[model samples]
Target: DASWISNGNVNGLGWSLKDQMGSEYFGLRACNRSLSALHAEMEGLLWATSCMRDMRITSVRFETDCSDLVDMTTNPMEWPTFATEIEMYQRLQEDFEDVSLSHILRSRNGRADALAKKARNRGYIFSHIDQTRSYGGVLRRIGSYIST
Candidate 1:
């Protein structure tokens, strides 16, 4: 999910990855230059893809509430405005064995939506990785420190 604060020209991007059981394994919230909500959604997906690649995740199915994003990603030629970003996504997909993007109802994406809104409101960046389950690693926070 992504959010924009017009006053500060801040764009907040957020994404959450969950297993079949619906437990979150990874999530991120970041602030960036102001962009349209659609562009911000694409940025969030790019960030999520890069993070999953770093974790050596071989297969992924990304879900977003933006139908236009899904169409743009699935058929890049159809969305000229996002041609560069679509090309970037293709490059990132090479690292994975399989990848797919789907659209979901906005109501079903509350967590990611909240994270994006929080980042927009706070005007900062942060990431939360739940590595404790299988990676035998502690939760890591890397970014500006600010009170909630």
Candidate 2:
């Protein structure tokens, strides 16, 4: 699963692939440079692919709030703004046996959303890192299950 949070000039991207037992392997990156929402979503997709490859995950479902992204991935072409990233994502998809991308409501993606927000607020860059409590109280209040 992937989530993206953006506030004006900052974009926070986060993704987690979990085992059946709910042990999450996740990554987060904060983009200090401003990017369009589509571009940011593409970046999140790239990160998700890298994570999936590193974990040796052959079949997986990716859930995101960006329906446009899901559509774009389904039919990739030379989009004026997101062409490069979209192409890269398409190439990455070929490496997996079953790559299912779905559009989900933001409210239903709370954990990943919270982590993205935390990454934006804290200026975090973590590749395959454990979940941490950097913003434990605020995240808990906002219904994020990130542990201390």
Each prediction's TM-score against the native?
0.80, 0.75
Give the alpha-carbon lDDT of every model.
Answer: 0.75, 0.67
Deviation (Å) of 134 in candidate 2:
20
Q: Tens digit of lDDT per residue, candidate 2, span 22-66? A: 355666666654456677777777877876876678899999988
User: What shift in Å separates residue 65 of candidate 2 from its native position after superposition?
Assistant: 0.6
Index of the highest-lDDT prediction: 1
Clashes of each: 0, 0
Scored against the true structure, residue 94 in model 1 reaches a CA lDDT of 99
Candidate 2 wrong stretches, greater than 4 Å: 1-9, 124-128, 131-148
Could you give candidate 1's per-residue lDDT for residues 1-148 as a string of tens digits? 8886556656766677766543455555666664577888888888889888987989999889999989998788889988989999999999999999999999998878887787777665555544323233444333332322
In Å, residue 11's CA in model 2 sits off its true spot by 2.1
